[model samples]
Target: MKLLTVLFIGLIMMGPSDPTFKVGEVAPDIALPNMNGEIVKLSSLRGQMVFIDFWASWCKPCRKENPQIVADYMKYKDEEFENGTGFTVYSISLDKKKEAWQKAISKDSLIWTTNVSDLMGWKNEAALRYKIGSLPMSYLIDGDGVIVAVNPRGDKLEKALKKNRKSESWFKSLFGY
Candidate 1:
């Protein structure tokens, strides 16, 4: 009975095994296969703001959200962030099949050059590292790889991006860009 009581207390004090990051925290780097079957590290785009999206081709809601993502990408691709010069999307697909992943990207007009996957579906390395428990989960990270928003979409995503970036007035005030 004393052993059982001690074990119970120890278990209660152990805390969660998986550490979760909230906004203002630096996101852990991820490395996986890009579209060309080449390994692409997430840290490669460190100087630019990146939206890391975890999605799968088979998920309808993810597919439906693709258009909005594409729109957001196009709109913010060339924008100047607070500490970054450019913005890009780092799409991580939870697809076990390469064909489906590539097909979905082409079909959705996802023009970003950083689409990547492990082709491991739910067992995707990056997805697991990011602790993705659902389809279409995402993180908007700053130039320094700090998470600014989680699961931001549509107008909400736009607002987050807008607020974080430097305005023309800000540039003019600071001796122009």
Candidate 2:
């Protein structure tokens, strides 16, 4: 009986563990310093569907994706979503040089205000928390903090946002006043 109990307990300990992050799971809140050194928390944007993005100033693909991201933010930032009304982008940079990151932000015209990073390049605290494996990774989280989609880009990103939008009445859809 003692041996059986030890085996059972060991098996229980080795059982599958819950994932820290996945689609439909609540994204862990992240708080980091912005360009100006003020700390920003991801949970502060809970009432909006936020795109939690990870990128770096030196990443070419991330630079390429910035234009579309900016366009999407401008288009949907004020629009209503099924779980949240407005949209926002919470960008996390894996940049070792703060000046380079700030310069890239200006050059890319990424206008949303919640940008953050630990300035540790690949070892950024937020990137480790999210287990990020690649550049330009993003999570589309709903207003309630649930991740609804991952890495939706360009038209797909727009479509995903539209898909979650509250349905409009026929009158609103059919004619402009």
- Residue by residue across 1-177, what tens digits does model 1's lDDT show? 999977754543342344366789889999887888888888899878898888878876778888988888888888888867688889999888999999999999989889999899879988777776666677888889988887776577887788778784386568843
Candidate 2, residues 46-102, lDDT tens digits: the string is 989899888888877778889988999998899877789899999999999999999
Query: What TM-score would candidate 1 get against the native?
Result: 0.83
Candidate 1 colliding pairs: none
State the weakest 10-residue window (summed lDDT) of model 1: 10-19
Error of 2 at 101 (Å): 0.3
Error of 2 at 131 (Å): 0.8
TM-score of 2: 0.82
Summing lDDT over every window of 10 consecutive residues in candidate 2, give the lowest-scoring window. 11-20
